[model samples]
Each structure stands twice: as structure tokens, then as C-alpha cells.
Target: MKKILVTGSAGFIGFHLTKALLERGDTVIGYDNINDYYDVNLKYGRLNELGIKKDKVKEHQLASSELYPNFRFVKADLCDREYLNQLFKENKFDYVINLAAQAGVRYSVENPQAYLDANVQGFLNILEACRHYPVKHLVYASSSSVYGSNTQMPFSVHHHTDHPLSLYAATKKSNEMMAHTYSHLFNIATTGIRFFTVYGSWGRPDMALFLFAEAIRKGEKIKVFNHGEMERDFTYVGDIVNGVMAALDKPATSNKEFDTNIPDAGSSNAPYRLYNIGNNQPVKLMDYIEALEKAMGKKAKKEFLPMQPGDVQKTYADVKDLINDFNYHPNTPLEKGIGKFVEWFIAYKDSKLK
Candidate 1:
């Protein structure tokens, strides 16, 4: 069984991916700061699903799961160099998935340093540890936000991501570049997966779906950005998890067809690759909210507002590369995904609110 280090394992997608790997019999170690960026309880609640008790997890210490012997967790910040090095040295991980990042667009505008600390410095730490410790593959999270203000029909990796609208987008774009540099210098096989709008059960509260659901449930006016004119390639969490695993299993190899004269932004002659993981189905913001309303059996009170700073008009993913290489396809219907999320939201609220 492969030993994998999944950073940000307590975060939404990271939690899901960690559980998936363990279920497949891979030995998995979870690392996270468990930052108060959102409700810390939600992060702990996710750990509950992995058989790790909230009380048992300690910072910089490894906590083992009784149910899953192959699973363990360590509470640590990504920028903690000494701790990261110790963990990597001890584990000798076969795969390293760097998902830890300060995640939010508007939040970044208010506090850009947090993004630099986690997304930039934290990423550098991961790359350094991997360079020294030597992992078989390094898969890090990128975002469709990197497309930033690009009104392209579908944001393809081949298109230029030089124009980022937000600090968050710029950081994600930096991650792709950082990964490429590591692959080039250290011969590290790196795959950067650009996630589209990911949402589902146990999703982040900061995301549109969760915020919309919470506001609707409370009968509060939800701020509809861009006056509900926005759109997103809303991909399901399960699809993203599967896609991540597929990418992790295939280590990047040198691209012989790559030419420096006409460089492809998606790949290089080095052991570096990039793929967009999304449903490739762009849904209007109003349509998405309507789906949630239908699922929740309640109508939303939308306060239409002008586009917020660092917010994009729409995001559509081009997963042609992912499909051609890994045969990955996201088939979760929008309604079905919303139904599951709504169901989870209701149950979660009932359990927590009471």
C-alpha cells in the first residue's frame, strides 16, 4: 500500500480525498492547521467521519484511527517547516497532495497576508520537503479562479492565466508555476489540478451553496453577486475526489512534444502537467440558486448586488486533457448534487442547531 501525505486533509475536498484513499487500503496521513477561517467544528466534524475523535487530535502529533488502521492525522500548519520535515522524514510518503491554502476571494482582499502565508510559503515548504524526502508524485490543488477575468467560453489550461483578477487567483496561478519549477529542477513528478467550483455534502460554508442555503434557511436576504448574472462549472465533490486519485496514480512524465518556441501552458518538457477537473457544465447563478431552492423546498430572498471585488463573471472548465489522459468524466447532475447537499445541510443543521 502507498503511503500518502494529504495536506489540508481537514478541509472539504482534502477530507473527502483522504477518506477515499484510506478506503482503497492506502496508508494516509492527514495534515492541517485547522484554521478558524470557517467554523472549526465543521472541520472537526469531517474528521469524525474518518474515525478520528476531535478530543484526540493534537497539534504536531499523529492521531491514529481505530477503525482504519491505515489512517492517521497530524494537526500542523503547512508553513511549519520543522514539523513538516519531521513528518515527511518519518513517513517516507509515496504521494504528497498539497491542498492546504488560505481559501477565499473576498477574504483575501481583506487579508492578503494569510494567502501569502499559506498558499505561497506553505507551498514552498511542501516543495522543499518533497525535494529532500523524495515523493513518487506531488499533486497540488489549483483553481479555475486562476482563469481570472478571462471571458473565454471554457477556461482551457492552454489559455494564458497571466491576468488574475484576485489575490487568490494570483496565488493559485503561482502554485502552477511553482509546481513546474520543482518538476524542472528536482525532477519531481508534479500534477496541478485546477478545480472548478466544487460543492456537495460537507462543503465549505464560504462557498455560494452553503451561504445561500444558510441565508435561505434563516429567511435572510442572500447577497446575489453580479446581480445573479454569474455562472460556474459546479462540479461535485465525489467527482473531484475520483479525479484527484486518478491523477495521483499517474505520475507526470516528460512531454516530448513540448516546445519552448511555442510553449504550452498546460505541460512542459519537464515532469510537469496540468489538468482542469470540473463537470464542464456551466450553470447560471440564478439557475444554481433555483436548484438549491427546489431541493430545500424553500424560496430564497436574493439581494442583487454589483459584482464584488475579485469576483469573476463565470467559470467553465475544459476537461479534455483530463479525459484524454485519465478517462475522467464528471457526470453528477446539478439537481442531484444540489439535492444531496440540501439534504446534508438540513440534517447537519438539525444535529448542530438543536
Candidate 2:
């Protein structure tokens, strides 16, 4: 079994990816800082569900279950360069999938430092460790927010992404560029996935689905930014995990015949690549709210608000290259995905109250 190190394994996407990898009999070393960026209980609750005990949820290490026998957890910050280097040296991981970051777009506008610390500096450390250790493939999370200010329908990797509107987007773009440099210099196979609005069970509480569910349950008015007219390519979490695993399996190779005269932003002569792993189906915010309302059997009190800063009107991913390379396709319907999320949310809320 190949050893894989997954950063932010306690976070929404990371948790799901780790579980998926373990189920497939891969040896996974999961790491997360367990910060209070959202709800710590929720994070621990996910670990508990995965059979990781509460007492072991601290820095430097713990194991989850005897059932897997191949799963380990490390509660550590990515920014700690020394700790990261030590982990790399000890584990000698074959694959590194980095999903850790300061996630929200609006939060970046308020606290840009968090973005720099986690997304920028932390990622730099990861890149350095990967360079030193020589992983087979390095797959890191990029954001669809990097396609900011572009009027292009269905954002494609081939398109120029220089006009990022948010600090969060800037950081993600920077990661792509950094990965390209590393791939060019060291021949490291690096694949960056520009994820759209991902949602499902055990998602972050800060996301729209979780926030809307909580507000509706509490009989509070949900803030409808952009007057509920915004659209998002809401990809299901399962599809994203599948795409990531596929990319990891197929390490990027240098496009030796790549033309420098007409440069392609998505692929280079080096072993670097980027893909847009999204639903390709943009759903309006109002429609998303309606779906939640139907699932919960309750309507949310709406507080219409103007579009916030660092927010975009729409996001649609063009997954042509993802399909061409990995035959990746996202098939989960919105209603079906949201139904599962609502079911879990209700059960989780009820359990918390008891």
C-alpha cells in the first residue's frame, strides 16, 4: 500500500478524502491544526465518527482505529516548518494531497494575514518538503475564486486568470504559479485542482448550505447576498474526492511539445497541470435555498443584501480537460446531494441538543 499524507484531514474535504483513501486500503497519514476557524466540536465529531478518540486530538500524532490499521492522524499546524520537515523525513510519503487553507473569501477581506499564514506560507513549506522528499505526485487544492472578474462562461483552465478580486483568489493563483516553478525546476509532478463550491454532509459550517440549514432551524433570517441571484457550480464532495484520487494516481508529465509562442496557462513544458473539478452545472442561490427549504420542511426568513466584497456573481467550471485526462465526471444532482446534507444536519443538531 502506498503511503499518502493528507493535510487538513479534519477539515470538510480532507476528512472525506482521508476516509475514502483508508477504505481503499491505502496507508494514510492525516494532519490538521484543529483550529477554531469554524466549530471545533464539529471537527472532533467527524473524527469521532471516523473512530478517532477525543483525547488524542492534539499536535504531533494519534491513530484512528484498529479496523483500518492503516490510518493515522496528526494534529499539527502546516506553518510549522520544522514539524513539517520532520514529518516528511519520518513518513517518506509517496503522495501528498494538500487541502488545508484559510477558506472563506469574505474572511480573507477582513483578515488577510490568516490567508498569508495558512494559504501562502503554509503551502510554501509543503512545497519545500515535497521537493526535499520527492513525492510521486503532489495534488493541492485551488479555488474557483481564482477566476474572479472574468465574464467567461464555464471557467476553463486554459483561460488567463490574472484578474483575481479577492486575497483568497490571489493566494490560490500564487499556489498554481509556485507549483509550476517547482515542477519546472525539480521535475516534481504537481497537479492543482481549482475546486468550485463544494458541499455535502459534514461540510464546513461557514458554507452557504450549513449556514442556511442552521438559520432555518433556529428560525432566524438568512442573509441572501446579491438578492439571492448569485450562481455557483456546487460540486458534491464525493465527486471531488474521486477526481483528486484519480489525479494523484496519474502523475503529470512534461508537455515536451508545448509551444512557448502560444503559451497554455493550464499545462507547461514541465510536469505541471491544472484542472477545474466542478459540477459544470451552475445553480442560482434562490434555487439552492428552495432546495434546502424543501429538504428541511421549513422556509427561511430572507434578508436580502447587496453583494459583499470579494464575492462573485457566478461560477461555472469547464471540466473538459479533467474529463480528457481522468475521465472525471460529476454526476450527483443538486437535490440529491442537498437532501443528504439536510438529513445529516438535522440528525447532528438533534444529537447535539440531547
Candidate 3:
């Protein structure tokens, strides 16, 4: 079995990916600080599903799950270098997936330092640890937000991501650069995924779908940002996991056709690669809200609002490279995905009240 280390295993994408890996018979060490970025209870709830008891977990402690014997959990932050080194030394991880970051664009606006500490410094530590302890591949999360201010439709990995509008986007773009540097200097196989607006069951409450569902369920007015003029390439969490696993199976390799004179931003001669894992379907904000309303069997009190700061007008991803390379196809229909999310939200909300 492949021994893997997945940071931010308590987070939405990390949780799903970790669970999927464990189910596939891989031994996984799940690491997360479990910070109160959104809701610690939600994080713990995900761990509970993985058979990890919150009462038994402690900072820097290693806990194994009863349900999945191959799965282990570590309560630690990425910025803690010494502890991270110790973890790497004790358990040599074949695959390292770094998903621990201070997420949210608006949150980064108010708390810029948090982004630097977690996204920048934290990721640096991961690279350092991988440098010290050789891993087969290092896969990290990048965001479509990195394409900020680019009015181009269907943003591709080969597109220029130099015009990031938010600190969060800047940090993600920095991760790709950092990964490329490490790949060149240390020969580490690093793959970065630029995820579009990912949404699904047990997703972050800060996400649009969860917030919209909660507001509609409470009979409260749901704020339509940009006066419902926005569009998003909402991708399901399951398909993203598939793409991630496929990439992990095949480590990054140099592109022989790559020309340094006019180099591509996605891949290079170094063992570094970038791919956009999105649905490639940009749905309008109004249509997304309507889908949720239909699934919940309720009408939302709409409150038209101007676009907030650090927000993009639209995000449509070009997944041609992802499909051609990894054979990864996100087949989840937008309406069907929304229905599944709505179903989970209703049950989850009811359970939380009790």
C-alpha cells in the first residue's frame, strides 16, 4: 500500500480525498491544525465520519481510525517546522498532498497575515520537508482566483495568472512558482491543481451553496452578489478527487516540446505541472440560486447587491489539459450536484439543531 500524507485532511477537499485514498487500500497520515477558520465542529464532523473521535485527538498527536485501519490523523499546523520534520522522519510519506491553507477571499482582505503565514510559510515548510525526505510526488491546491482580473473566458492553465486581485490568489500563484522552483532545484515532482468553485455535500459553510441553502431554509433573504450578474464554473468535489488521484499516479515529467524562449505557464522542462480541474460550465448566479430553491422546495427572498470587493465577475475553466493528460472528466451535472448538496444540507442542518 502506498503511504501518503495529506495535509488539511479535515478540510472539504482534503477530507474527501483522504477518505477516498483510504478506501483504495492506501495507508494515509491525515494532518490538520483544525483551525477555527470556519467552524471547528464541521471539521470534527468530517473526522467523525472517518471514525476519528475528537475527544481523543490532541495537538501534534497521531491517532488512528477504527473504521479505516489504514487511516491515521495528526493534529498539527504546516508552519510548525520541527514537528513537521519529526513527522516526516518517523513516517516516510510516498505522496504528499498539501491542502492546508487559510481559505476565503474576503477573509484574506481583513486578515492578510493569515494568508501569508498559512499559505506561504506553511507551504514552504512542506517543500522543505519534501526536500529533506524524498517523496514520489507533491500535489498542492491552486485556485482559479489566480486568474483574477483576466476577462478571458474558460481560463486555462497555460494562461497568464499575473493579475491576481486578492492576497489569497496571490498566495496560490506563489505556490505554483515555489513548486516550480523546487522542481527545478531539488528535482521534486510537483503538481498544482487550479480548482474552480468547488462545491458539494459537507462543504465549507463559507461557500456560496451552503450559505444560500441556509438563508433560504431560514426564510431569510439570500444576497445575490453583483446584482446576480456573476457566473461560476462550479465543480463537484468527487470529480476533483479523481483528477487528484490520477495526477498522483503519474508524477510530473518534463515536456520535451517545451521551449524556454516562449515557455508555457502550465508545464516546463522541470518536474512541475499545473492543471485546471473545473467543470468548464459557467452558470449564472441567478440560475444557481434557482437550482438550490428548486431542490429545497422553497423560494428564496432575493436581495440584489453590488459585487463585493475581492470578488470576480465570472470563472470558467478550460479542462482540456486535465482531460488529455489525466483522463479526468467532471461529469456531474450542475443541477444534480446542487440537488445532492441541498439534500445533505437539509439533513445536516436538522442534525445540528438536535
lDDT of each: 0.94, 0.93, 0.93
Over the full model, what C-alpha lDDT does candidate 2 score relative to the true structure? 0.93
Off by over 4 Å in 1: none
Q: Rank the candidates by TM-score, best first.
A: 3, 1, 2
lDDT of 2 at 68: 68
Q: State model 1's lDDT.
A: 0.94
For residue 153, give model 2's deviation from the true position in Å.
0.9
Q: Candidate 2: where is the Cα deviation over 4 Å? A: 64-66
Of the pair 2 and 3, which is ahead by lDDT?
A: 3
lDDT of 2 by residue, 39-149 (tens): 999998878766788797767766666456888888999999999999999989999999999999999999999999999999999999999998999999999999999
Candidate 3 structure quality by residue, lDDT tens digits, 1-354: 799999999999999999999999999999999999888999999999998999978998999897999998989999999999999999999999999999999999999999999999999999999999999999999999999999978898888889999999999999999999999999999999999999999999999999999998889999888999999999999989998999999999988889999999999999999999999889898999888889999999999999988999999999998889977788899889888888888899999999
- Candidate 3: give the clashing pairs: none
**TM-scores vs. true structure, each candidate:** 0.99, 0.98, 0.99
Of the pair 2 and 3, which is ahead by TM-score?
3
Q: Give candidate 3 misplaced runs (Cα > 4 Å).
A: none
**Candidate 1 TM-score, C-alpha based:** 0.99
